[model samples]
Target: MSIGKKLANKTETVRGAAKKYLGRATGNTRLRTEGRLEQAKGNTKQAGAKAKDIFKR
Candidate 1:
């Protein structure tokens, strides 16, 4: 993937991790679930990008 897309995905993953930890510390199940979903979404996107790059070779 492009640099911008890679950065965006990484940011999302980092933000999600922060939110997840914050939610755990504050006992917020909703926030925790949202964080987990966000992380998964970011990871999936990154994986898809990698697959595309591999196929382009």
Candidate 2:
């Protein structure tokens, strides 16, 4: 993956993790779920990028 894309994905994952922990600490179930979904989205995008890179080779 390109540098920008990799950085964006990593940022998303980190942001989601922060949100998840914050929500848990604050007792916000909705926020926690949103964070989990966001993390999953970031992971899925990263996986797709890796697949594309592999195919390009």
Quote the positional error of residue 1 for candidate 2 in Å: 3.0
lDDT of 2 at 50: 92
Q: Can you list the residue pairs that collide in candidate 2?
A: none
Worst 10 residues of 2 by lDDT: 10-19
RMSD of each: 0.7, 0.8
Taken over the whole model, the C-alpha lDDT of each candidate is: 0.90, 0.89
- TM-score list, all predictions: 0.94, 0.92
**Number of the predicted model whose TM-score against the real structure is largest:** 1
Decoy 2 TM-score against native: 0.92
Model 1: per-residue Cα lDDT over 1-57, one tens digit each: 789999999899888888888889999999998888888888888899999999999
Worst 10 residues of 1 by lDDT: 13-22
Residue 39 in candidate 2, Cα distance off native in Å: 0.5
